[model samples]
Target: MILLISPEQTDDIEIKTLHQLFEAGLEHFHFRKPNATLDEHRAYLEQIDPTYYPYIMTHNFPVELTQEYAIKGIHLEERKWREQGAALETYVKSFTDKGFAVSSSYHEPEDLAAQPVTFAYHLLSPVFAAISKSDMQGRGFDVRDIPKFIAGMGGINAQTTPEAVKLGFQGVGALGGVWNAKDPIQAFKEMQSAFAKAYNKKI
Candidate 1:
């Protein structure tokens, strides 16, 4: 199970929560504070032990931020992905050549189906209603509705991870679910456990 930790707001509490996840063995921790400046982000990165996990920068800031930290991957937003067009694929290919992986977001299955570029995988969203996005509705795709090689994002947590995996999500992304939990580390573990159980039963 691949655990993605995305905190909507990065604060001292959020940083501590992330530290807990690091100790809990979550491999992929994406730093996606959209409102934070590069300097603020750097400070947050300083608190995290980069050697223990894969840290991904969610937006295309400067490549320098990632280069400085030796982070393994970058996740592009939908707008940046659309704007780059062919350049996005070229960028991923270039990163692949350099040993860095790339990921992007796609809301709909057709968008993923239409994708012609290579990425580690695309993140498809709103598998359930997220605390961060209460207004957004989930697609509620069953196993047959999902294609191969897509990660389920939005509202993913311990409670819904089983359903997400049974629906054929390659992995699951958590936002407020883990970050806002009473005990984030435990929440992460339970979520991973759920995915593992569901995945095993499916096989």
Candidate 2:
């Protein structure tokens, strides 16, 4: 799948860019705004086309909006997944019982392998160096043996996305590769082309 993550800073251009990307066949959108307030988050979603709501996934306040907006799923950050422990299991169950997909993140391949398979999917990051954060280096780990639920993330772009697919990632998630590009929509299409070229299928 081709998942586009929101940058920390959201602007009118980014919002318009995202609509264009979705219209062009972007499948998933991770709505992560760490700095935005709750009201701001609501406002941002309000501005987006309601038809695109089903493709949206939020990292924050997911429970409140999952049913409210009829969104696709919720993504629990690694911190919440770890700190909440069993309590989080109940939370996941609540959503899963209602047919909501649950996903999370893991910084290490080993951690993801060892953890119970509760999440529908989990992100394995820094797999090809971070595009948004230069200081964050790529692990270059091969996750072919891991479960299909683990998506390779970080530093994912047109060039690196195919590499991730070759590494056996069920999906690839991009942030800076799209939002940081000269033409974000074009970059997304290029990423899609790269994925198709490598995997022989559309994202």
Candidate 3:
């Protein structure tokens, strides 16, 4: 499953929470800290169990760090997408040379047109009214609106993950739904079970 680390700060509790998530069968992690400094991010990384999860750094941070940690890949935010999209050939070649897979956020169809650089995947969002951000709209996408080469994020959890899969998402990512749960392990199991149910039902 995809576990998105949207911690406000690199605090002790956040680190502990991340460790728990990693232990709970999460292998894909997205570190999308938009306001953190390089030092702050480094400090957070220091707290994580490097061997367990394929930690993906946001484009705002230094890409070199991923190589240093031997992480799976990097999450290309808007900036990286625009910058790399301009030179897709060179960008893909260099990153692939380093054995790094690429993932990025896509909120629109226009974004899809620009993608073909051998990215491992993409994340589309706000599939439901997310508890973390109640004011944010769920983008009104049901099972019919999903795109190929994409996973669903934003407010996704045990309850909605099944619906997300039915809508054509290959995987699901979570934030407050899992992290803010009264019992994270239970939440993880529920989400995992929901995904399994969807997969089995399809077969």
Candidate 4:
């Protein structure tokens, strides 16, 4: 899987680029805008072609937004899932019952392994030095033994995508690697091509 994460902030050019990426066959789009309000998020989705709604996974207001739009599913940020405590399974089931996917983020492999509620997939970060945040150091996590469908985040780009695959990541998630590129569309295609070459399967 090749997951593309949204930048924290939005811009007109980014929106246009997003449409182009969707057309270019972006499958998993994590719509994460931490500071955007619900209305703002809705507005952003409205700008995109509705046909790509099935490829989107919102990071905020999962319950509200998923009900209103035919988005792929919801994502539980680390804090949100941790805060669920004993209610995590029930929360996930609520969406699963609706035939929507529910994924979550984790910082540690052990924490992800011990997670009781089975998410559609799990996101583990800082596998390499982060491109979006310079201060965060890379952990170089190797999940080869983990049985879960874990996607490696942090410092992922065309160059490091094959490395992540070799490290046993079932997927790769990118933010800065694509958004920070001189050409986001070409950057995405490069990552896809690199991933396919490494995994021996098209994403």
lDDT tens per residue, model 1, 98-180: 67778888877788777888777778887777756789878775545545577788778888888888788878888777777
lDDT of 2: 0.86
TM-scores for every predicted model: 0.91, 0.95, 0.87, 0.97
Q: How far is candidate 1 from the true structure (C-alpha RMSD, Å)?
A: 1.8
lDDT of 1 at 78: 80
On residues 1-203, what C-alpha lDDT tens digit does candidate 3 reach at each position?
A: 45565655455577777677677777777776778787877776777776853655545454656656766767776566777556866865677678777777766645654566667777777777776787877864553453457777777888888888787777787877877888876888788889889967866
Q: Considering lDDT, where higher is better, how would the candidates rank from best to worst?
A: 4, 2, 1, 3
Question: On residues 1-203, what C-alpha lDDT tens digit does candidate 2 reach at each position?
Answer: 78888999877688888889989998788999999987888889988899998888889887778757878888988897898876877878888898888889999888888887488888989898899999999998788897657778999999898788878887889999988999998999999988878877524
User: Distance (Å) between predicted and true CA of 105, model 3?
Assistant: 0.5
Off by over 4 Å in 3: 53-59, 142-147
Give the residue spans of candidate 4 off by over 4 A: 201-203
Top-scoring candidate (lDDT): 4
| lDDT for predicted candidate 1 compared with the true structure | 0.74
The residue-level lDDT of candidate 4 at 34 comes to 91
lDDT of each: 0.74, 0.86, 0.70, 0.94
Cα lDDT tens digits, model 4, 1-203, are: 89999999998698899989988879999999999999999999998889999999999989889999999999998999999899999989999999999999999999999998999999999999999999988899999999999999999999999999999999999999999999999999999999989988524
TM-score ranking from best candidate downward: 4, 2, 1, 3
